[model samples]
Target: MRFRMALYPLLGDLKTICLTLAYLYGLTVYDASYLALGKLLSGDVYTADGKSSKRRRGAK
Candidate 1:
């Protein structure tokens, strides 16, 4: 019977993988502005929920 004890190593690897994913996501969002072509092609670039671009005064 072989009882596995690779928990620590597995956890460390998982942590590294998660960090890398987060890093990539952050980079993508950070460079989103530079990739405006794609967004424009997809459609509207402004507005948070695709509602309206007009900002009402004193509604901040």
Candidate 2:
């Protein structure tokens, strides 16, 4: 199967969400942004950073 990727511009609301996630999760804004986008699209988030992944899972 082929997966297509699209670019999304982060607007004000997304930036705010990312900031909040970063604060709540103790993740960098960059990592939180990925989480925010996953929440927005109702999609799963995959990461190579085990520590961050553990933190995300623990929050749930």
Candidate 3:
């Protein structure tokens, strides 16, 4: 009976750790995906139409 009491708390702690790990993993994946999407959205691309007027670093 005494051992069972000790085991209960250990099991609860293990469960909590597992849950926290999963949440952090999900958060990291979301952060990575967000960065990828931002990069894709903010990239400079020229279209077939004559609408791009990009400027260089050193030019009049």
Best by TM-score: 2
Q: After superposition, how far is residue 40 of candidate 1 from its true place, in Å?
A: 35
Instruction: Indicate the worst ten consecutive residues by lDDT in candidate 1.
Output: 51-60
TM-score of each: 0.26, 0.78, 0.25
lDDT of 1 by residue, 1-60 (tens): 989643222234444443443354443322333223323335443435322223211112
lDDT of 3 by residue, 1-60 (tens): 355422222234444443443354433332333323333346443324222122111111
Which of 1 and 2 is the better model by TM-score?
2
All candidates: CA RMSD in angstroms? 16.5, 2.0, 21.7
Better of 2 and 3 by lDDT: 2
The model with the greatest lDDT is 2
Give the per-residue lDDT digits (tens) of candidate 2, residues 1-60: 999998877888778878888898898888888888888778888888988897777433
Q: Measured by TM-score, how close is model 1 to the native structure? A: 0.26
lDDT (0 to 1) per candidate: 0.34, 0.81, 0.33
